[model samples]
Target: MCWDDGMVDPAPTDTGRAPADEPAARPAVRIAVAQRVPPRYGDPPALRRLATAATDANGADLLLVPELYPAGFRLDTDELAELAESRESFAAHLGAVARTHRIAIVAGYPERGPDDTVYSSAIFVDADGTELAHYRKLHLFGDETAAFGRGHQVPPVCRWRGWGVGLALCYDIEFPELARLLADRGADLICVPAGNMVGYSEVPEVLVPARACENQVFVAYANYCNSDDEFDYDGHSVVASPYGSLLAEAGQDEPQVLMVDLDPGLQAAARAHNTHRNDRRHDVYRGPDPTIG
Candidate 1:
């Protein structure tokens, strides 16, 4: 059942199943996280740079980029509206990039929704240029509240290249409920496109891995490394395993791309030993009865 009424449960097609001839020991997926600052708002170079990054991630199955990578981060409401593009335009551009490079992508963009409202949004394009999912950032942080509309839909889990891939934005990753919801919906990997600042190093260092361990899913966080007009990003892009281990991490201030292989076996093993999801006491997790207190 959907926990939120606004959430549309995406029908997950079994596109990720391994064939009988495939070897069991083979890694399920290879992902690349690009931790670089894009061109400033309204700069045409930003779109070109994303395509270039896709080429850089040549052999990987998927590429995860930072939040608002098309437009510069730290925009006011006016700039956000001005910079936001229709989801179709963004998707088409991303599709071309993905098709050219033969790599699935989860990249952020400022979406110009109906009625000209803007949102901090991300889209997932399959390697074959099919648009799989679109997720607007749900939990806004700081200036984001004034800049964009809150997303009303829960993130969807899509089957892609032998994995159940899910999407979330920077601040959204910090909230345990969202990640748990994704896990419960059968997400094997949660990809976060973030714009975390210098003061929040622990998010990538501590919280991300914790989320992965708790849910028995791989979590990949891609963040900007350089400073924008208003914020200096921390740039510790990382990939965490189901075992809560750091598979890869980028540096604090340098542009980097981290590549890691995700083994489905790890998730199976983690679930075998740590059945946290199964151990939850849902009946006791409700709010206090208003009649009693």
Candidate 2:
């Protein structure tokens, strides 16, 4: 595991959370995050690289890649619209990769919606090549605001190999509300495909783990490294555990694939100790105060 200097290793110790004899409720799931540079638009070499990554991640239950990977992240609105792929075409390609490698995949792309609008989207496909969910990014970041239309629907939690997985793109994961909503709807894990550039290292350093710890779920953030014409991607891709622990991390300057195993016992223990879900003061949060109309 690649350790970040900021995060401490969560070695086992006596935390009075769960009893020693309790059985772990969920099976362990392994995930892989590909941290690399995305090829430019219309580059076939990029797809070959992705296939190689999938081939390399043979044993992991799921493989995640960066946001806007197919079309790259630096395109303008006109370029994005021109490059936007139909959902059917995206599925056919990614599904083939998923089946060939026998690994589930969550990847981001630009989609041409049926309404003639283009949106930033991500799709989840099981190992058998079945498309489970297609999520349009609810939050658009920076240049993305002008490049694509924002989504109206919330992401769906998908059931994959006994794990409840939810999908989010780069900017979406930064919203605590989104993560909390997913947790409320029974997501055990959230996979984020991000184009998190140089200035936003803090997102992986702080928010990612905080979201995981607070919600008692695993979060895997896959991002690109290296520079493009307009942006420099800071590859601090990470998998944060439910205990706010950094399970695995990739450095800021290199291309890497970080793999980690998710143990359900850890999540069970964290929830036992924190109990945030039970402790939330919803009535106070919802509000009907005499002072405020």
Q: Put down candidate 2 lDDT per residue, 28-67, tens digits, no spaces.
A: 9889999977676567744576688898787899999998
Which tens-of-lDDT digit does each residue in 1-293 have in candidate 1?
A: 21232555545334322121122434578899999965665567566888988988888999999998888676688777777899899999999989989999999989999889899999999988899898888999877788898998878777676566788999999999999878777677899999899898999999999999998889999999878667788999999998899999999988888989888777788867777877776557776665784
Worst 10 residues of 1 by lDDT: 15-24
Runs in model 2 deviating more than 4 A are 1-23
Candidate 1 stretches greater than 4 Å from native: 1-27, 42-44, 286-293
For candidate 1, the TM-score is 0.89
lDDT accuracy of residue 177 in candidate 1: 94
The true-versus-predicted C-alpha distance at residue 146 of model 1, in Å, is 0.6
List clashing residue pairs in candidate 2.
none
